[model samples]
Target chain A: MHDGILTIDLDAIVANWRQLAARVAPSVCAAVVKANAYGLGMVPVSQALWRAGCANFFVATTDEGLLLREALPQARIVVLGGVRPGREQGFVEAGLWPSLFSLDAIERWLVATAASGTSAPCVINLNSGMTRLGMSPQELQRFIESADAERLDVKIFMSHLACADEPGHPLNQQQLTQYSQLVPAVKARWPEVVLSFANSSGIFLGQEFHFDLARPGAAMYGVNPTPALPNPMRPVVSLRLPVIQYRTITEPSWVGYSATVQVQAGQRLAVVLGGYADGLLRRLSNRGEGELAGHRVPIIGRVSMDATIFDVSAIPEAQLPPIGEAWVDMLSPVLDVNLVAEHMNTIGYEVLTNLGSRYHRNYVGGAS
Target chain B: MHDGILTIDLDAIVANWRQLAARVAPSVCAAVVKANAYGLGMVPVSQALWRAGCANFFVATTDEGLLLREALPQARIVVLGGVRPGREQGFVEAGLWPSLFSLDAIERWLVATAASGTSAPCVINLNSGMTRLGMSPQELQRFIESADAERLDVKIFMSHLACADEPGHPLNQQQLTQYSQLVPAVKARWPEVVLSFANSSGIFLGQEFHFDLARPGAAMYGVNPTPALPNPMRPVVSLRLPVIQYRTITEPSWVGYSATVQVQAGQRLAVVLGGYADGLLRRLSNRGEGELAGHRVPIIGRVSMDATIFDVSAIPEAQLPPIGEAWVDMLSPVLDVNLVAEHMNTIGYEVLTNLGSRYHRNYVGGAS
Candidate 1:
């Protein structure tokens, strides 16, 4: 972040973690820093959670595990996708635990560990219902038979919930039952290994889902895991862009690409330097609203590569800040990260991770 | 891109440029490689165009120009937003030609150039109508009086059209007239400087919009510069994802986040690893369609952050590919990038640029 464009509240992140952590009471809380902490700068985000007493961390790939290790050298880092061929050594070198999803992966890890003369740190991923990236019950049993789980240094046995976000969904109960049945089997084979199943949403699915560790990602960054309940999270990321130029378009002046919008009579249009390339979703171009000195400014034209035009005439007191000044005194009330996700017809994860790298990012709290 | 993830055809890119260059006929074609060649890899995209005889390239900011210079070492790189305070020195160090917009930026560039004991490379940007960036006609006159345009090493005098995409829109004519007036003024000051105007959309506005150089961005990547005409360009990028698992869903088996989708009796569902985080709009999950073994497959559920479920029950001969294998036997219909842009409520630029680093990108075509 080189422009002082966005200020991320790390305290908000810690507070959101505390709120989610409180719900799981006695269960240990883990931070999911996968996808660059959902695109909010993972190192800083995880450091904040670590200070807030987060002991465990989960990441999707080996690269992510390496990043987390660099940040939290003492924390237990679990690689969610397990070790792939040619990558087991990287995991070992980084002191990262690989999530074993297949018999082949386990066998490969065992071979790599033997080759390196090192005890392989491992986690077992069981497929409860989401038939993706996890070992099936049959596969797990076959693995246990072929290779002794007791011999391997397994750290955690985990399963993901497909419908944990929706508490009313029946599959959550079915997945809970299926995953729980495998837990005893896993524990019997490897009694020393801890168990973790819940993600951000699953952590909210009551104590049953919170086995031993709760891995919270989005909720820790302020998305409501339980939408039905009042949101316990405060927004952690605040995006702001500098107002490049301001112009009052009398009646006929048009704005932006394809002439998607026309300035009405007596409208003051403020052109912003940030555009879709800057991660201001083009769909939100004309449909969205921003702020200028607390005055709500309507985005009035098609967003271009590096510029968006907003109508500021409505705000009588709104003075266009100089070119370098951030127009958003705070986060735009009309812009929600989730809403941008929805507007892009994508999930919040995509919206977060896809955020442009051009913005000058500032963290208010945390390890920074 | 590994496993047929996403293929970028350099041929299509060069072909698009050649076609646009042909449309501009005698006008020298300049390519807009800003925003990292509209989110396609800038180095490769610009190199291809440069090989195809494009002499000029445009970027949004000075920083972009500085980085792009490493790729096209000898190419004439133009920084469209001009020199901001604290950035002009770096611009000079990188050998960038800045499009001078404001009086302050002009003065600063001159001062920096004098201080560095170098002739400053510059371009005069006249604000014909789009008040976003560039100097006004009045400012142009003032600039000529204040600065030594002859000694400034001005390369191109240009203006941007606000509504070139809409050829019928009168603003084009107004901007064209305003810009035409400044061309003479600019010529009077520096007759040797080349003239450039017309972005991707403006090129389609006929010969009038074209000058000594035409800078086209989206058109080079296959977006329709002229929406009224049949598309003369081919898409440069294609995204493909592997089907991780295929499962038999008994009546009412839930799929994906929130269990929003329920498989009916005898339905078959294939889970895909690519999701919104991979840059596929989540709305494309259940609402979009793909082709499996030449048979249409409708997506079956809400798109998860990392997975999507597709209804492959209709494809009778469908056999689930092993995990990590590209479901190439199932080819999605050739969807237009523009339509995908529309679906994502953004232009193709965002959709392409937002593509995550996780994707393995493969480029096909000649060095040009």
Candidate 2:
């Protein structure tokens, strides 16, 4: 009786992680459970992954790190958004490691460590070429030469890939080359420091990206890390929205908000209880498709806030789902997130992360 | 300490509702608090409206209707998505009214009423020119003639306008004309039954469209009901994201995932702790603008799941807030949800409904 049912295959997520782990064998594979595991519920997904052998977890903010700590007390949690000023003690008190992006942040961590009287091992994020976060190679060189860098217990030296999804992009090689140059200096300072260089897509880029530790987020949640090739991971989520209203077009008329589209007299329509507010993505109106009674149906008009109308005339009259009993499958193994992303003109990560909280979440398969 | 702060001015919402209520003077103004009051926290918004003389409230689902019933015990709560078959008892037990789209749904409500041995009132949804839901005019006439119609309490006869946002759309007049003819017949059956004909945008379509109860959702939350005219409602929400990493581009560099955009040397950039996952649409990459210290900054690249990069070189170094203290304003009175929606190629409803739950929610003034 919920708006829709969001079925998450925990086994599929675990299998995906295991497959990536096997691909990056010998290198420690860390799980990136940030953004609520890309909007699939962080606690449950991380617990499933933790039980499956994953020990290290990466999240976006300090709050998420604290939440993951509460969920899996023994798992190594790293906050990629780093420590906010004045909130540093909470990180040290919770035993959650913060990823330091700048020297100023590194200095703040040192201050927190001194105040808390705790040895907080932190990750150093390097800006290889993303130009989004972290210190540049030159900054890395300058920091390593400074005496303050020696006082900190640096656990991981990590950098992100800007174009890892596109293997042919020259920036991939350039970023790899730039980050590789700083490895020796960092290793010289801290021989025991783990080097993490690859993300989900980066793993598919090659062993050159495997490094010592790799953290993959999108791929573990069933996104296609290798977009150029067929998806190797099992589909991790399936969504089915309940049809609340079923109607037959009595005349030639417009449908949905703004009367964006039309239907003929013989057409049949089903209004589902989920819409853009439920993460159907308003841009998907009149573009997306749904599976109803094993028949393909086209969305007819602008998606409303709480309902989406689909033209279900393709199905035989006998197979039409009665109003309260039938449900429309929006996402399944055949219609995965990548396909939905394509229709929404965005990436799979955006599609997954944008999934709303109005659904009845059901988890299955985590035995492995 | 937080990723960002989302300030919701509850007073503006109440003011907007009152303004709309005055616009349709003598007609009861029902507040549509569906989709978590368009993602502004339903309970608070509904309670504020309830205290300000609003008695009728409409929600999208049975769950929401139940929640609203619990929040404002004395207020009339109507479930627009209607009652599921087996879940009908919950609605009758809770005294939650449902919008019945079909005669079949009406029969189910009757069954729930008989089983509970309590009288239940429901709304009859008319298709009016929108083929998305409800019975056709011919079916409505037939239902009114049925014996079952005399046994139930029909409190409101509601029909949604598909083109009310567009004043010039022919469908508005057509829908109005069709619904107007049913008024006499429906009144003969239930003289006390209220007629709800307008949503947020429909209220602007003139008084002829406003019947007994006018339900406004978006306009009450600061979405411009009249799309072609200047927004008259006060802005209700403002969002600011913390800058976790601020750096000056030292060389020509690409930014964010896939390396879609480049930045010149000497450019300053700030990576904020909110991205697509946090309701910053991914399409806003290289297109959206944010304000930092009152200076406008353009977004630099693709919004990641947890971060977005803004080129903040326009701000003078002396005026720049230190790394953790700086926060970029994504939404404000000037940069309201409508403007953000324009950049996202969507609507304000989509913008408001898509706001994620990760930020610190601060609710301000609700004083009448």
Candidate 3:
């Protein structure tokens, strides 16, 4: 097979989840399985996490929630993106909980629930300081004063962190303060409502941020929750690319598309079958590095749609394998996802999610 | 329903192919269906192209070739990445043509053919300029001198352009000269061997660059074949993202993750359900622009994994639709793929291929 191999260590993922779960002990550690579990196959990841005692799962859309519900019959699946106007009945029918971000969303949910004659559980998202989602303070106040809001069966009151990755960012403290004030008002209305505030990065922002539940997404996939410090999570993914061919230029030659890299005489190059289409960003052109026989090789020239060339001159001739039968490590323990993200001028989350479906995915150490 | 809508116009694709084909009349116009037809669903694209009189198809790897073979049993499918050492038999058995790039690949193909007791048709890739693949001049000479190379059945001799996008780049002329010299030498060995050159952009470099076969990939997908001139091809894709909610912040607030953008009071923000995980690059944060009810809005702060907030203060309140039932055009006729690529400092090719699978894909105008 010429396609690259994407080996996902489910044990490492489980270990990362366990590590984060241990860090925020006594608090509910919900798994965020949105974006197909960050593009690593949601069903498999969710199944593995469910087997590891994770009862609560968060997904981006109602469709994802339905899929997760199908996989985990008894788990509490929350739709983070909430329900689209006419799609509320679908969410209700699937027994999925929608995180009502606005007063309008709450009203729509109430209508769906009243029509079904079933008081479906829901979550209220309060906009602390992040203006992206959730009900604004004024909206929250108006909803809190309304009888309709009180009539619905609210399960969890949650808010997303805006600057959780940077613990020292002033917005973190500001958001925490806003969240603290908002939760009390929410508790006054629904005294038994569970509070969930912390995300992957927020879990590391101290115990105050970690309320009743912690929704960690990237951290479980081995992305560093605390970017300023060492990662407490174990690496989960390793990508190995198939070497198409190896060539030694006897004269000065330009390599790859656009002739961006000029190679000297006797410079050896190995063209690998992995490129931007495979989630290897074009920004990684000439900047990315790969490993061959334990030796580092710098990628030369622009990354093509389906292939990239790496300068493998540094590796000893004895260490190099036969041209068409060799595989090089593009992403591994040595060159982790985070480092590759840095090379591409993005975060590990983008790198992970952008991983194409072309890879031959292999799952290791998951529940049978 | 919160997922973005990616509408692909296959008729526009057919139109583009017709335009390119008309430009190089009598030269067999082959379609490059590599990278899942540049991440626009290969099966549908190939079927449409095949019906449009496209007899030849090119793919990146053997796996892609196998898929195309399953779809088009009678079409000439060429594997550009060539056959891996022990995998040559599979390619032969599947009746797929492998572009042999090196002398070693030729040797392995001979061995595989000997073991299978059947001669498989193959193409010879000559390293005219782009050194990423194919045999070097020295290697090509050695192969031509070998008796084993004469035993194998070769169909076409091809080389890739290095700088076809740049009309004035010296490398274009240099590669053309090299390809011209190499093709004649190969023809002397095999008089019936057809010559294939010119990619999408190379097709616009005039008839001289267009050999017996012209392979166009990006042009058929609505990418500009001639970057220096107006795009002769019609747009093929349009992406529309759902607006999850609209918020009017009355207090100072941060818009998205890391608190990248600080918003003033009375600022209107609309959170759209599309982010980097949805193939929108993070580099587009605070730079990308989306259209809401015909008004362009700047994306605020950092784009989260599942959401992005757009500054909709410029848009009139009366023009805006209901919060939960509205959608903004992320990529449309107003905001094309090329412009979006500019915001991320990349090309339209990356933007098209990076499009995530979560979107509800709708194919319009093809074979009907």
Candidate 4:
């Protein structure tokens, strides 16, 4: 196996989910399994989460919702992207709830429900401050005032937090205030409507933010919810790349593409079989570090398409194993995902999601 | 489909390969189909290239070489990563050529060959300038002097270019000089040894760089080969993402996570169903632009896992299609791969290889 090994700890994922669930007790914690459960394989992550007592799941599209429905038959799978006009039957038949973002989508779902002669439970996504998705305040008000609200089976009234990651951001308070105001108005018409406003970061804000359900995606996948504070979540993935070859330069030499790094004479360099194509970002060329035994080795030069060279001169001679027999940990408990993200000038979410399919993925410690 | 549509023009790929092949005529133009053909699906891309009369294929690892061998039984598949000790049987059985980069690998292959009583052809990779992989100058000299050189079935003497993209880089000339020197030395012992050098950019460096074979990967995938000159290759990929939702904010509001972009009252935003997880880098949060009905729209705020909000205020309201019916061209003739790379502060190769699997891939116009 020349490909890197991506070991995913499902047990750690479950523990993280449980921790988040415990944080917001009495409020249901829904797992966001969109983007293939943040590129950690949706089926396995969702199964593990479901086993940890997660009853509600959120996916980006109806297609993902369908896949999740097949994986978790009893869990309530909600498509956050909502229903397309012609493709409503898939969501309806599969018992997948579409988070209707606009009045047009609401009307389309209503028509589909009427055609099927069966009303499907759905969430009404209200836009508080984030202008990306959901219905505007005017549109929401109009929907609540109209008789269309009476015809639809609305189970949840949800709104996404724009600046939830930042606890002190004014937009969070603004969104929270708008959502708090809208929930009562929604409940006035539909008293049984469940309110779900908090996300991963929002759950850390306060108990007031946690209403009926808390949706956490990144935290469960081992991404730091609180950027300013230390991460409370356990590490879930460790990437181990094999050393394809090692070379010693007796003269001054350049390494990798663009001739970026210059190596001193008699310096040992190990070429690992993992690069940008394996989701090791090109930005991590000279910045990234890998762990060999207990010592850290700095990655030298530009990251190639399928290889990255690391300066292993700091390690003792006896510690260095033969090329194929040795491996370097790109991501581990010590070299955490957050640090990798920092090195790449991005977030942990990008690091985890960009992890390519070339790795030999091993999902360890699920229900078994 | 809610997922983004990835349209791969195989005819364009063939045209690009033909162009590269034409550039290095009389010399073998092998296709580097490693990293799953730079994340464009290896099987389809290799098949298309094979149909275009590409007889030689280069892959990163033995596993990839095996897969390519299965795809094109008669084609010469060279594993650039070489054999991993005990895994030599698979390569020998599959008739895959392993490019030995080190003396350790050479010794292992010799043992595997002697045990099996089969002398499989292999390539000796020499380190001319880039010390990332292959045998160093000293190691190559020692190997040539050793008695083991007489027993090996070495077919090709290859060296990779370090700064081939930069035509005027001193390292290019240095590498060429070193490789030129090594070629004659290798041919002195083994008169039948074939010399292979020159990548996609190296083909443009001059005819001198193109020895016996030119291995091009990125240019065939529509990445700019000669950065200083106009690209001779045709565009092979176009990505179109659906508009999941659209909203007109009537108040001062934030868009996407982190409240990165503050929108003025009555600003229109379209949430497209593609984000960082879909290989759209998070660095492109507020910098990236997409085309909607020939109008360029700037992406506002942070790019989420499954969605990106595009500021579509410039686009005429009459031209805007219904929410789900509308689509934006993320990568097209106008929004080329190189342009996206610039937006993400990376190279076109990184952009192409980082392309995720969630997109509904459509391959069009192959050899009929």
What are the models' TM-scores? 0.86, 0.99, 0.98, 0.98
DockQ score, prediction 2: 0.86
lDDT of 1 by residue, B1-368 (tens): 13226677888899888988898888889888888777778888888877888878898876688788988888998887666667777887888998877776677788899999999788888777765676757767876876465557777899888778778988899889988887877777777889888888888888988998998888888776777676667777777766645565544556666667666768777665556656666656567666555566777777666566788887663454545543632222266677676555555666776666656667889475
Tens digits of per-residue lDDT, candidate 4, B8-80, equal 9999999999999999998889899899999888899999988889988889977788788888899888889
CA error at residue A279 for candidate 3, angstroms: 0.4
CAPRI accuracy category, model 2? high
For candidate 1, report its TM-score. 0.86
After superposing candidate 2, which stretches have Cα over 4 Å from the reference?
Answer: none
Q: Residue A312's C-alpha lDDT in candidate 4?
A: 93
lDDT for position B318 in model 2: 85
Ranking by lDDT: 2, 4, 3, 1
The chain A TM-scores for the candidates, taken one by one, are: 0.93, 0.98, 0.98, 0.98
Candidate 3 clashes between residue pairs 3 or more apart in a chain or in different chains: none
Q: Report per-candidate DockQ.
A: 0.36, 0.86, 0.79, 0.80
Lowest-lDDT window of 10 residues in candidate 4 chain B? B246-255
Minimal lDDT window, size 10, model 1 chain B: B324-333
lDDT of 4 by residue, A242-355 (tens): 988877668888888998879898898888888999899999899999998678999999988889999999987788987667999999999999999999998899999999
User: Judged by TM-score, which candidate is best?
Assistant: 2
**Model 3 off-target regions past 4 Å?**
none
